[model samples]
Structures are given as structure tokens and as C-alpha cells.
Target: MAKEVSCPNCGKPVEWSEQSQWRPFCSERCRLIDLGEWLNESHRIADPTDAPSEDPPPSDDLSTPH
Candidate 1:
């Protein structure tokens, strides 16, 4: 039997098998909606470090004059 999973966006039951093109999503619409959320910054992956990313300090080593 194929494993069943709930759609991440719609809570619809989905079959975890080769036929499930969208896999975790119920349909293309649901997938697009989820994509839109990420694109709009409504969804974000939790940073494991739990700290805002910062740019590395500029290197002080001066390059040899070309």
C-alpha cells in the first residue's frame, strides 16, 4: 500500500507514490500558493542558529599592488 500524507497547504489526503506529482501538495494550485508564500516572504525556513546572518568582516590584508 502506498503511504498516505496530508497536503502541507490544504490538509488533503495524498498518496505517496509515483502518481503523486505534487507529492506533499494536493494540486498545482496548492503548490503555487505555497511558492507564492515563500516568494512573498510569508514563509521562511527557521534558522537553526537562531541568529540574524551578518556579512563577514572585510579582510584587512591588502593585496599586492598590481
Candidate 2:
């Protein structure tokens, strides 16, 4: 027997097998919904930690000729 997994979008039970076209998502609607969320920036991956940077700006000597 194949193991079952829940759909990420609608929380529906999905079979983890070759027969399941949408393995993570239950249906096309759910898949599209998830895509829309990503496109709209509703879903984001969190960073491990926030660090401040103190890098200096690049010199503009190359842009100006003597």
C-alpha cells in the first residue's frame, strides 16, 4: 500500500503514488491557488537570522576620466 499525504493547499488526503498527478496538491485548483499565493508574495521563506551590513560604497573613479 502507498502512503498518503495531506495536500498543502486544501489539506486534502492524497495518495503518494504514481497515480496521483498532483502529489502535494489535491487538484489543479489547489495547485493554482498555491501558485497565486507565491506570485502575490503571500508565502515567503524565513531567513535563519537578520544581520546588519556595514559595507562601504564602491569608488566612482572609473566612471570619471582625468
Q: Candidate 1: how many backbone clashes?
A: 0
Question: Model 2, range 1-66, lDDT digits (tens) per residue?
Answer: 999999999899999898889888888899898889887563344432344566676667676666
Candidate 1 TM-score over all chains jointly: 0.60
Task: Record all residue pairs in model 1 with backbone atoms less than 3 Å apart, i.e. clashing.
Answer: none
Which residue segments of model 1 deviate by more than 4 Å?
42-66
lDDT of each: 0.82, 0.80
Q: Write the per-residue lDDT of candidate 1 for residues 1-66, one digit (tens) a residue.
A: 999999999999999998989988888899999889886663245544556778776666565443
Q: CA shift at 36, candidate 2, in angstroms?
A: 1.0
- Give all TM-scores, in the order shown: 0.60, 0.59
Model 2, TM vs. native? 0.59
Candidate 1 lDDT for residue 3: 95
* Best-performing candidate as measured by lDDT: 1
